[model samples]
Target: MSAIASSTSPQPSSSPGTTRNTNVTILLACLGVFASYLPVVGVAVALPVIQQALDASTAGLQWVTDAFILPTAALLLTCGMLGELYGRKKVYLAGLTLFCAGSLVCLTAPGIVLVCVGQALAGVGAAALLPSTLALISHVCPDRRKRARAIALWTASLGLGLTLGPVVNGVIVEHLSWRWIFLPSLVIGVMIVVVGMAFLKESRASRDPHLDVPGQLLAIVAITGLVYGVIEGGSAGWASPAVIAAFLVAGAAFVAFVVVELRSPCPMLDMRLFGSRAFSGAAFVMTVTLFAQVGLVFALSEYFGLVHHASTLDIGIRLLALNGFTVLLGPLVGRLMNRTGPGLLLVTGLVISGIGALCVCFFHASTDTGTAALVIAVLGVGIALAMAPITTIAMNSLPRRLAGTAGAANSALRQIGSALGPAVFGAVLTDRTLATLPAHLAESGLNPADQGQVGGVVAHVGIQAGAFLRLDTPTATERALSAYGASFTDALHMCALVSGIGMLVAAAVALVLIGVRNRSPHDATPEPATA
Candidate 1:
């Protein structure tokens, strides 16, 4: 086996200037990660505004979000491989440039289609940026303790972005315009480019491997098709031909992707990485974590807006309970990781988060926001404990040379979960709302004919359940409002149950697969780079 050392392998630097440069590098990488994540949650606050401005349907709003997620999730592995083959700095800069351009396009987008196109462009940029940012950190910080701290900071920056995205966007959309949401991201993108050019050093693999074009294509098709099917299944019946075809295409593409990767000499994602229990377990935990986190974020954002008639600012504030704890506790958790081992943190975190989610299942329209916030804070604590440590464990499981691939694979899986979270949760929420709407309406003392008429309106406007709640018209009757509230509450309960169940399963997986032994800092053992 040929070992190709990464150029980023840490060198001792005692000089003041070198230390300052190292700090700057970490900052720049964190900024890059921050930029990539900002859009993911920030845009949720703006969805209603965009829908109103563009006269977009619920599916259109979903596509606006999914457009970005699809490409980001699909292309992450390819971009990660390219970063190693080309140069990490070069790819990083290019991603920032594209992201800036996409932001500009979104700022000026006249319709939802244009906005979605711009989002897709940004997704492509994020695909390049996410893995490279982590790889750069792994390269610069060699000491396990220092690396863990840096990774914690990196995770915190992501949480900060996720934390700020909604609040900032909410304030902007409320006081200014939805278009201004992209402005800060645009400025940040430009600033990062300048800082990257000045301080970021170039790093790449010692030898370039063959690009896996077929594997890349298959992966993209599979992911895009699956996301499409999930999103469409909510509005278009699950049995609809279009939805069925999307699932079939996704399945076939996934099978083809596996075959191509197994055959390719230099596959984008090495299938063998799953052979390591630690690596596979970490990946599974990540997917499950994001699935629950992102889905709840999406669902609850709508819940706040639709059920409570929360202003954008209020919705953002409500979400802070979940994200704020993540940002605040991330570094502390990182510091403790050496003593705890990831297994304990993972199991403990998932269980706590599951409990939080299960608690939320009891919420109703009249439930106090304080009660919801308290439970969400518990969920946040769980996420903080698990998030950074999982990354550390996954990277440590691989050889130094394959760190880039490891980061990419871990990130790609997380994004896949992120995408699925919203799609599946949204689908379930919509289905539950439709099923329960009639019963709730009838019980509210509406005549049979009136109930039928209200149901038609719900079928049309209720595609975007949250947005439909905001509508002021005939269906906004006292009884109709009550029915919609009850229906949404029912949906929220189901969504929370699903999230809780997923976390429990993840906790079980962590116990079975993650190692309980903590590696000593002095023990420097390298695993073979088989992939």
Candidate 2:
């Protein structure tokens, strides 16, 4: 971390009149935020319906999800700086309006292309809401415990949104149309904007610098290019010319982004934060943990829908095992943080998530529903344990004034992990499916064309179907099942290895960098400062 990268002074205290204003402002802020984030998880349940409705190709299916995340990843730092410069309240309100506008786009989109554009717009809204919400929270809840609780509540909203998104989408898509997903948010957004107009006070940042225009542009281009390349790489072979070109451009852009940030007078993101042992360590762990969680979600969605032939509603109910645990455990873990701090919770959470990954790895093609549910539930527990602690560590490490930017950056990191995890893991699974299929085809005595078809089927169905296959097979059906069983197990093994490696890396960093609790807000007296 650059030495100069240390936190600026804390914001001034709220006067009596300001206190009441802050509370109402925060309430509106929270509601707007919740409405925005609600879409993140909500779309998962609608994936199948959208796939069918749009006649989406296999590769196109991945893009549907990636489109929403890529823009959010690309523009996070830029939007944060916007809030820090103009005022968080203004930035936040603009984000809400954009989100609702994006929702409108999604609601009326006639094709996947338009829908994707809408998702990208929502990503912009995310970039805006994510950071500004944390900033406002810091301003509103000054007490450490109160702030921590509020942070926990805010974080929980993310998990809650993900969990409920599916349930709501499932019911809506099942009964009506997919457009309803975006429609509800528009209504809620209108209310938030109305309430916000009356109560929210504009908060100018306590410190500001000349906006680093060149650096901001480079960072956005680099991240956007990188994510686009990765997602495109997954669908197109990584070696494809277009994919390779994206990677090259992304690499060059990233290099430029780094150079610009290092020299910029007013860098959007403090590049020095990466040098801090604590920040870097926490950020890495948080990123990797999110990768596993989201990757698992992508994997399971395929497993349930394609293999188990589960309905969206059923998938929602089934995934409740995972999301349910997350919803239940988040608050309890937050309360625990008050006494134990976050390090232990992080380690424990990762361990559980690792274990959960293991459970998923061992799943048999014929694994009972009860058993599958248990495995998913365990993974959820791990996520619940890990998410809050990592967030708290990241937030508390910073000066209170930068809390919003830190929160937004943290949120962005998690999404980056979410984006990369599924892409990489999906690649691994795809490669393994291709590699293992030739042998399975030969073993089953199928000719080349039949073999290719089998490989394609296995890619989609093996995760669920292979789990139940018996190894000793005399019949043709038995033989095919055995092959699938082996392939699925191999894929699961790969997922386990990835999860284990990520967890071990996180655990090592946390053990070394995280020390005894040292800093507290009470350490200094409040003072008014200028932006």
Candidate 3:
């Protein structure tokens, strides 16, 4: 084992030329994060249009987002080490290059499969970009206060990308093809690559970085298997052989991962970090909170496009209520963080988020725009409140020596939750809606043959089949529409119950495990960050 990197201040002489270089590096680093997060929510917002255009299934739609997130999550820990061994600037630009390539692929894709492939490529790029950007900032601004400020701006840029995803894609898809969603990302990515290559200085650590290849592969399999099982189970059947196999593989791989980490001399994640109650509690809170936030974004997008038949731009505007508060409440959230305990803030936020999700249970097909926005705003507020405290809880609970791996693991878990959010929520929505759709159709006063015909169309077209439910005689479109809406609303209720109750349960767990006290030992100093 080697001594860590951040022992002393590495701030360069405060000259005008050096200052200019540092500012430019920070700008590029911020842009890298912005680009990484841009498509995360954007792709989810575009799910409805992609489904309709490609005639995709529920599982296929889940993959469209998960493919990007899965690789990003699985490879995150490894990528940082790679950058440390090689060079941060090179890895940073490599990440943008791949992201641009993914965007190009998406721009030209003719099928859902191709789109997923493109997203997977972008996911790999994101994995590389996130950590290298942080390393660049750490390298350029070595003074603790300045680095902190740079990281804050970097964090804000990430939130901006997430917040704006819906609006950007909404505007683009409304005017052109859904594929145009990638055009802006593509152009920015290419520009960054070109500029960064010219001006971005290279930096690397002094040692050959440790590689945990086996643990990395196992972690990937575990997450991919779990998500695939959930998504495919709904589309196929719960008892299907493939689903059974995926679950079994995931379970086995997870166990193997724990064992490998415990025994490895140079583990990717320090398993002992979870021994702290605060660390465990904070990790759980982040995972569950993000699960609700990202999952709800997906559900609402589908609701607006399929249930209410809203335009792309309108759907984006309505969804804005969900994330707009995060940006608006930024200063407030920061002030509250200083005045309150992370555990307490997390608990309060979860309770408020639970109430917000519970409110979503009341929404129906005819629910007006204003009412829906109000409920989403409450949920968004809770998310914003709960989000930042997670970092405090996790980082403070462990020794400074564990900072890099601890941060990496905490971040990886959050991404895992993100990947699963759409997979699990979309699956639940599809399962309940399809299972009870027949009963609603039967109650529509339509005869058996006509009922079966409409059912077939629903099967072929999936949730957005409301537009194709016309009948020749004796059957009215209103009856079919009523049946479909009722079924979908019932399904949405199940998702709401899960999200609402899940948050409350997570709050209880946090209360049991976390404390308000300062938990870190003062004996060890923080090692220098070695991206």
Candidate 4:
């Protein structure tokens, strides 16, 4: 119960060093950032392969992805605090070591359970990696201009990871094996460890840091419970005792988290940050944007693999239009923030993305790849416009001393949204497919008794609409495929509506709560903070 006030001490001064030292530091930090995010989207491209190889159910597939996201989101604030209390360099190297170990485990895992365990370990590592990387950049680059450029490069590395993950995984899964997805990450992790040990400096806050253990545990309980409930509710009846109990536990945990954070002498999350409209709005923008982006990628990757029956490489190529634009436009967006301001970019980007998401509502199984590519390209452009600007807004909204915490908070929220995107959208897709299945099956001219015979298969199809198209049974006739396609299209449309509406709502939030007034003269340049 220490009552130490948060301090705003200047960044620790580094020795006057050669330009080579700075470059190497930036390079190593960027590499760590890239490796941390590489697995986020890469796994989506390999989901079908994993599903078949591991005989994973739809829920299992979701868990495979979410297991990583869960710890990354849940432990981020705590990890960031730990980085401040201990040494950023120490926490970062430890994280890389754990990440490498997790990658090795995933590479050699014999079952889906072990794979999930491995992903969870990697997630814990990521929780330690992300904030520390950004904090290190801020610490080493004390000059405002150099710091800005360094942070921008770090942000670009994130986009690069998102962009390259799918395509690289596609190539590996198609040519080598799904297990190879983690191999490159393992190598990169080791390289970062060696380079970081030689070049990175130790940095910590001047204030005595308190680890909010109760708040951290509560966050894990809340997020895990809510996500589990959402994913399971799709299969178990929504009102089933298990789902209901999970939601209840999540609700109670969240309430407890708020209470603990509010009363703690030194909170993990300073709830007061939310009192600022601009800070809250920027966080919301990051959340909803990723909610649409991640969920769309997950759904479309499955559509490409299961519905279009495209190869993994083809799926990656198709997705290039969406992810590529984000990487390309990141720098330009940062430059534009000075002129047009983040508010305009935020609103414009969300609106454009919303339009792109809604456009998918018109897509059918026969939609050409070219048209799909064009639609996703628009989505990518919109995300690019918003992503960097949103980060700028969130970081600038706080005092310079809190930059590390701001980064951690924004990232944690974004990861929560990332976790929710798949769970919520996947639930909608499963439920809509299940609800639409019976009527479609009835219309296919099956007698009630014959339909009853296929009831078990229908349930499986509902769990994964793509599973229906993969079936070779007599029950999976031409009519059945058509019925399943219609059902899937309907479910996708519902998913689109949800994502589209979310973006639009985010746009409204930005318009009302966020403005250009907070934009610093240097376009929200980052200040020095403890790593």
Candidate 5:
């Protein structure tokens, strides 16, 4: 490993001037994260509405979300490197500009294609923002304890964006068009850019090296191919030639990436970083916990809309229980992390969420708001506990100059996990629902003809057959609804089990390798005149 990678990150002196700059930088960084995340759950909740308005196919609808994820995942490392090479503030500003433009495109979009184009633009911007924001925090905060507190706030901001995305969009769609969902993200992004340009400090790697072209290309290919396979496997048959080809491409690209990184003089992502047990453990835990949380949110959102037939606003309100706790408990979690270490908290968070996931199996089509809120609250609190610690763990594992790369690697992995969440859970939902369809339909007392009708549509669109389920055939329709609801709940349980198992695995990883203390030394005098 390069000596720079082993050195502690720059520790800004604790003078009044630098302290003021750090606070502003942290606030701006949090806003940047918040802006990037607004479209995530916000757009998700609006999918059905988009479908109705745009008359989109299932594949097109999937692309609406996937378009945003692909560039964010594919370009994170490159963007991180760019921030490391150039100035982080410059890249961050550029990201905000792109995001603003993308938001504008989506806001005024005339059709589904334009919406996708807009989302892709925003994804690229997010690619720039995610790592730069982290790098900024890692570079600016002089004190480790303060860094922990700042990170806690940063994580809370992320959760707040996610928590409010649905509610904001829901309220928008209640009176306005679905297009208005893009507005909040746009407004916030632009405001951040304007303010940040004046106040945010600049930082970069102390050393410069040639870009690892081969490694970067392979990483893009691997991530894109893997996401494509999982996404297609759910929509297309898993054994289909395209899906299989995508997996093969992803696997091959990943192998090539490993080989290239090992041999490269200046690898885009350092191969040696993974040699540390702490780094590896934190990375793994980050992926699985994200997979569980994002997957749970995706599954439960479907449950509220498809099975419970809740309105968009109603569903968003109910989901507050799932993400709001992160905001409520984030600072406290940070303080606890300082006192108790990240290891105990990370494991406890995972276990609590895991148990809550199991509790999801108890939910049914007839579950009331109160009952659903309680169960979701438990999962939210658990995930909130686990979220901040891993980021700190990953940061502490790496030394100063590699802060941007570490942030990139961490963000990339988490984004990959988030992208996988819906695709994997949706696949499980569709497969399980179809596999158990016959039994439910038979019990519904529907005739052979009606069974074939409901089964065919569900086979084609899975649980998204909300409109088809609303067909008015009196007793037959009612029976079909009941059968579909039962099948959806069964699928929900399967999804919950998958996520719960993932959480347990993460908890185990946390206990073994990721310790509770900061590994990076912070003894150096910090840079002067940051702003």
Candidate 6:
């Protein structure tokens, strides 16, 4: 192994000037991450407009979103490993360059195919940008206390990006053309490149060179099969041969990944970290909480738009409760983690979130804004509490030298959770809605033709069927809503139950990680910053 792979990240000095520069470096990293994430949410809101304008197919529309996620998820570990082997600064700058190029591709692309290609390019940039920022935080704040605070800020930027992406997209789509979505990202990417060139410093890798190509290839195959199976299985019957094949492929790929990783030198992830109680526990909670929160937000957005007839602006505003508290709570949560341990915060957050999900079970088609807000707000609070400490424990569990890889692993786990949560919940809701269709159609007293119309391969019948079923008779409204209510409630209950399991996993992890003590003053000093 080369010395580059075995070395530790450089430490920044504690001097005031160095501290300021460290903050700047963190800011630049955050900006890059923020810009990368902008496209995910922004493009989603712009999708309908793009489809309308460009005559895109359903598959093309899906690709517009999936293109970003597939590459970002597949290559996260690779980017993290690259940072460890080459240097954080060089890799980070490279990511920014790709991001700029991708944004430009989207801006100038002639059709939907090219747009998907652009998103794929952006995903690569996002993969690199996400883990690098966390690694940089580990390097910049060598002291655990300051590092916790810095991570809090970094996580806050993530929330900001997600929260703002749709709002920005809505503005651009309403006033200008859909292509304008890529314009701002281009400007931001250039800014990140310029700032990185001026301020960022290169860091030495922590270990000798061993690229672990076999492990990486296996991991990619595994994740691709899994994501593909997930998206397709929901539409294709679960019992269908295609779905079964996807699952089988995914399972085989997973087994291959484990075998390859165990044998490879310098594997992308250090699987042994799972042996640390704290690392495993915190990571488990992260995946669960992310699944619950991100999945719920996705479901609710559609509910507001399709069922409640909310406009794009209205949907954005109404959905604010989901992520709004996350930004507000960052600093306070950081200070609280500094005062207390991660165990208390994580457990409390999960419990609160589980309760919030349960509240959605009581929701009706006629649910008022205040009630809706209250339900989402509870989930948001839970998310606010859970996010900070889970990260704290995950990073703090390892020795400083392994922080970069650990951060990458933690992030990959969370993204996996985010991806899975929506897939599972969406499937449940979709299946239950279809199963209840006969009961609803009979109750509506619609003719056979009308019933057929309601039955003909509707998307999200779970959400919109309630309103349409009530349109015929005023007295029928209550009974019609009852059926829809029952179905939606069943879906919510399932989601809550699943999320509760996630919470329990988090709580168990916190308990087992055993000891993470308060930082002493000496350990809180700023360490030298690394790229």
Question: What is the C-alpha lDDT profile of model 1 across 1-531, one tens digit per residue?
Answer: 123443433323212236677688789989998988887889878887888989998778878888888888888888888887777788889989988888999999999999999999998999888888877777777667777788888888889999999899988998898999999999999999998998887776655456778988898899888877877775677899999999999999999998887777667776766777777788898999899988988788878888888898898899897878778987787778767766677688889989888888989987898898898899888888878877887777666556577778878888889888887888888888889998998898777776777688777766344334332345446667778788888999999999999998988887887855676212433344543
CA lDDT of 173 in candidate 3?
A: 74
List lDDT for all candidates, in order.
0.80, 0.71, 0.74, 0.76, 0.84, 0.72
- Model 5 lDDT per residue over 395-499, tens place: 767665666887888899889999889888988887888888779999989999989889888877656783257444789888998998898899999999999
Which lDDT tens digits does candidate 6 get at residues 225-332? 777777676556577787788789879988888766656555666565566666667777787788777777767766666556677767777777666777788888
Native-vs-model 3 lDDT? 0.74
How many clashes in each structure? 0, 10, 3, 0, 3, 13
Best model per TM-score: 5
Task: Give candidate 1 misplaced runs (Cα > 4 Å).
Answer: 1-17, 463-476, 520-531
Which stretches of model 4 miss by more than 4 angstroms? 1-23, 51-62, 141-149, 438-456, 460-476, 521-531
Query: Candidate 5 versus the native: TM-score?
Result: 0.94
| Model 2, C-alpha of 504: deviation from truth (Å) | 3.1
**Model 3 regions lying over 4 Å from their true place:** 1-29, 44-62, 84-90, 109-114, 133-155, 194-208, 396-404, 438-461, 473-475, 516-531
For all predictions, the C-alpha RMSD in Å is: 3.2, 4.5, 4.2, 3.8, 3.8, 4.3
Relative to the true structure, candidate 6 has a C-alpha RMSD (angstroms) of 4.3
lDDT-best of 2 and 4: 4
Give stretches of model 5 more than 4 Å off. Answer: 1-17, 470-473, 516-531
Best by lDDT: 5
For all predicted structures, in order, the TM-scores are 0.92, 0.87, 0.84, 0.89, 0.94, 0.89
Clashes of 2: 10
**lDDT: worst 10-residue window of model 4:** 521-530
Clashing pairs in model 2, backbone N/Cα/C closer than 3 A: 1-275, 42-165, 206-530, 206-531, 364-467, 365-466, 365-467, 365-468, 366-467, 366-468
By TM-score, the better pick of 2 and 3 is 2
Lowest-scoring 10 consecutive residues by lDDT in candidate 6? 522-531
What are the clashing pairs of model 1?
Answer: none
